[model samples]
Target: MNSRKQVASSFTSATQIPISKEILETPVVTTIVSSSDEEEEMSFEADLWVSLTKTGKQKTPNMIRNDLQKYIDECKENGTSSQAKIVKSLAVDNDSFRKFMNPKNYPDQWSATKNETYWAATKLLEKVKHEKKSTKVATVSSARSKRKTSDSPCISQKKTKSELRSDLKALIARVHAVPNVAQNGGVYDSCTEVVAKIKKFLNRDGMTKALFLEAVLGGVNPHILAKFLAGKKQDQCETIVYRTAYVFFEKLRILEGRKKSKARNINEERYPQGFSLTKK
Candidate 1:
């Protein structure tokens, strides 16, 4: 009767073990799951990287997650949980990850630090950078070619002699010394010389009336000269010439003063006292 009771007790205990616990304790047959999952994720990254490089389009993590969800599910079903885990971690939804993946979508949030997806993303980013550099170089090359073609003397358009002469004549007429030229021989000579110089300047291909005025006026305001040339204001040639010369001379004097000051400092540094033979 005791032996019978022992058997009953053992059977009852065995039966009490939960079905869920048994399922948990059951060993899976897959042994290379960890290694296989890594390999699968690597393969997925390579394929995705190729897609990214070709399009130059930023892929959001959500978009990437959606695309890989099926593959991850299949891996998980196949007991390649490690591989699925890797893929899931790569597609982890976070602000930093999202910003890194689709920088164009969230430019302000963009960050470029090394992370779990750095290697895969770098493949695409590097390719994009190279393509942009190549495109920029090509654009610059095309622009330089255009500039060279346009700047070539044979290709450059030039004003006709008649047009140049007319423009120069108008420019001179605007700056002429009113009735002073008839009264003063010096004024008449200067006027004649100015006309001759303008004619010579117009005969050149590259020279313009504005350029000639710029040369004559040195650093003076060209717009003021332009106004006078346009006949919007009146000023005698003698007055304009005297004023320009005065300004030019004044600039020269200022420059000379600065040079003298620098020389005096250097001399003092060298001598340290009066250099004259007669002592104070």
Candidate 2:
């Protein structure tokens, strides 16, 4: 039994491969960084971009306009006055304040109703606020909701710090169980498949709030584990898994060792992609 334990310990030690500086310094995946339910997991901003890119040239301005209009109308109908959410959803370009404000882009700049929404969104977003963000951040809200702010319909909400740690602890455990990133590709391939599946699901069904919070909070979506860590810091162990989790929606594909582009421009994304855990 002692020998067996020794063997297991050796195996575990062997698996703890040194992470290359190249890996951590790898060029971040580029993304238009930007939430969920069982019927509605992943982020709406990420989902929107997914649908748009998939449609390709086939997606006309009118189609985008209609979609934007529908989203705006729905928010107002639901009495949701979350300017932050609305702004984030509409403005995807990291630097362009008017990315979604133009008539050529999507929203009708001439119309009062749409223009109101557009200006409000822009005013809420501080310039350079997204500078530090990266590609992995495009999808997902925070793991926990803020106390029912004035905008929140709920009367109040709370979660102890212990609960947050417990949840993160479980998620890190699952990430470790996945193939090690230090070995070959890690969970990058699996990550891609899951993200594609999520994009397809959202595009096919369109938007539905009936199950949004549940998916965002993880009643049905496994991606929430990744989602929760979006745009957040990571420790040593969590960093390993963050690399794989980030692969799901990263736009920046280059790493530090790769050839850097001369004409390449960098933009800040809202969500985080890479992850790591500090403790054993």
Candidate 3:
């Protein structure tokens, strides 16, 4: 019995969810901030669970459920359930529909993400239900209109770093905007500058993927990801994200050490216990 009142494993409660497609695609175990300044993730237990579970295997664990999934194990008495099951049921659960859709009725501390999750679950169900017949005119046109900039050549509109950091896609745009001077004789930004900027903008969660993506790969270039991030069997997206972050933070350890050393040096010149070192 989930004390929160176990929701039915359905997706009816979700509607008009406002989350972005990019956030939906990211792996849930994503690092937000480094301990010293950055960090790594996607725990083995979660991976193992995904390997063993049959539900929602289509999407990466990095999305939303990782935060909401652990209760499933505790919920064993209710029988094995995945976030997918929960959202699928919520989609149509009339009680949830009320709580998620109406702001005035929102449960205490309940973010609108609940609605977003349901919407994702609903779309997922629809996709699973209709796996065939991809040749549709209107659908194709509609999709083209919504095409992600990351899927192709970068088309950047100028935005402040603050604006870019506020949203992942906006940050992606910043990462994508590494103008190639050789090709277009545009302004060239060194990789170091970009990495520094990314590290500065991210929060202290030590879980953000933006820092590592830029530090190792120059940026989360979707074009490059096709060549290096995917393998024949499992996707290496989460692997690279953590691997690079690990290395990035390991280097930061040196910075942390230096900071301590500087403090020690200042302390080394301490005044005599009872008397001042400086002449009166």
Q: Could you tell which candidate, 1 or 3, scores higher by TM-score?
A: 3
Of candidate 1, the 10-residue stretch with the lowest lDDT total is: 27-36
Pairwise TM-score winner, candidates 2 and 3: 2
Put down candidate 3 lDDT per residue, 50-155, tens digits, no spaces: 1112342223222323423444344455676664465554444645644554456533222333344433433333333233323365478758856765476676
Q: Model 3 segments beyond 4 Å from truth?
A: 1-83, 86-212, 223-243, 257-280
TM-score of 3: 0.20
* Candidate 2 or 1, higher TM-score: 2
Model 2 residue 244 lDDT score: 38
Model 2 C-alpha lDDT per residue in residues 57-125, reported as the tens digit of each score? 222233444555565577688887453466565443433434443555533222222233332232223
List the candidate numbers ranked by TM-score, top first: 2, 3, 1
Q: lDDT values of the candidates?
A: 0.39, 0.34, 0.35
Worst lDDT 10-window in candidate 2: 262-271
TM-score for every candidate vs. truth? 0.17, 0.28, 0.20
